[model samples]
Target: MSQAKKIMNDPENLVDETLDGLVAISNGLLAREPGSRVVRSTKIEQGKVGLLVGGGSGHEPMYGAFVGPGLANASVSGDIFAAPAPQHVQEAIEAADAGAGVLIVYGNYAGDVMNFDMGAETAEEDSDIESKTVLVRDDVATDDYEGRRGIGGAFYVVKAAGAACAKGMSLEEAAEVTERVQYNTRTIGVAVRAGILPDTGKRTFELGDDEMEIGLGMHGEVGVERSKMMTADEVAKKMVDMVADDLPYESGDRVAVYINNLGATTQMELLIVYRKVAELLAERGLKVERTDIGAHFTSQDMAGFSLTLLKLTDEIAELIDAPCESVPFTQG
Candidate 1:
């Protein structure tokens, strides 16, 4: 088989090199922990609850890019599609610790749960810094709610917790807000094609020209169903219907919509999807308080997108509107 073509000094150095580049270009906004894959903010507000997040390397601007003011104070990264080591997670926990406490936000993947949990235990045992966690499980395709995998809806969870911290909320308060965000969100994704694995230089999954997979995972995990391709509007209605009905979002309720690109899909295509989403919501008399469309989370080179909706209460809406500064996301 032909080796995969990647622009890099060495595949082994990809993660480290990427971290170095990110910090250098951050304009003093970020710093790297010595000899570790953890990256943290250079400025942490005193006496506020610190927010920490982490995951593998392939999903750029995700667990890492979202670290900054009004967001995560630090983030830990592992190898592509691999969970960070417990020690790496611990470093982030330590970096995010303010006098108040720290809150760890991450996906519901098994490895992430185990490592972050271990890191929290280690921090308490060593330094007595109180830490808590909120696991994001927004994918609606899975029947096992507790075991549902986290995906695009993670953005809402981070935003809620970060804002709570920014408001000087206690650790318990921040954690409660984050949990509320997690429960009030739902996401569903479809893939027209699979992504290529950098290590192997091959597609993670195979799809025919006329086929699409619904509820596909970020890491190429099996989806719930496969069928012939549908029009952009048809796909939009199908996904939005599933997500909306699951939450039983009422006609008078407002929501925040996030349309995320998986990897290789064009912005024009994503916009087309969003247009249909907007129209469908209007038809249902559901108000769109906010809408975000772009490639926030991705499966490396995967050709598809996911839709996330956050059912909004006054508190959640206010928190979502709060200011945030991060590498990939910033708002007033």
Candidate 2:
């Protein structure tokens, strides 16, 4: 019944303003096209398979923050909770294109799929630049695996693909690695609170004070179940079980345990969740190869966390170890 408090000056300019901030903070590592919304990395190497990731703007540090050496070559953003236009997507493709080919990665949202597909087609039609698409459907909140939403789990998918390209893999090969990682990854999230939509200035979803959402998506859609609040260990146990069982990760499988803060969940809270997650994985004999306990893909101001299990084959592990440098993220 009241205006949602937002710090931005205008909702209409939020996306562009956000891009401006990203470019500024990047300190010469990233740049925005002249009068265009495509944010490209200034550090893209010459003659490698171009890597591009695009989606709506609300999920900060994802699809955009991912641009740099060893990650996405470019990223295009749409308005708040919306997909980028085809033209913008095409511009991103052009920015990413360095001759070999381009590999497009995004969540399985229909708008993203359509826009990215059209963008790829336009690139080929206009400039003869070949490209491939890898759709991420790693969220196991739904029974239909193929129809699942791409959540925080997409981070590793991008990492693997970017590393593959950085390692001199072909477009087709990098695309394959991207898809393989997507399939091997699974995620499940729980939100104890909702995020505010800058466009609407309202909470993305509603929850009673004593309630928590299970299997919540980044978009703030109602989760699969709503239950009274649970302790950190209880929540972690429930979420870890759901994610691990859906992927059917076995006793001997090596995995990277990722704990993603939806938006506002605190460090202390997530680390506690990770503790139980790690203990559970050990009990199941699943080898923990790495643990990523921080924000990768976030929904603005949403107080929750998502757990991602990236089953690491030797290949995925090697790719994960490759060096990458982005303003907000860097790894080796």
TM-score of 2: 0.98
Per-residue CA lDDT of model 2 for 1-332, tens digit only, reads 56668788877888888999999999899999656779998988888998999899899989777999999999999888789999998889999998899999999998888888998899899988999999989888889987889999888899888898888889989998888989999999999889999888789889999999999888887678899999999998888889889879999999998888888988999888888889999998999989887777889999999999999999999998789999777986
Per-residue lDDT value at 184 in model 1:
94
Runs of candidate 1 exceeding 4 Å displacement: 1-4
Per-residue CA lDDT of model 1 for 21-57, tens digit only, reads 8888888999995567889988789899999988988
TM-score of each: 0.97, 0.98
Question: lDDT per model, in order?
Answer: 0.89, 0.89
Question: Candidate 1: deviation at residue 187, Å?
Answer: 0.4
lDDT of 2: 0.89
Candidate 2 stretches greater than 4 Å from native: 1-3
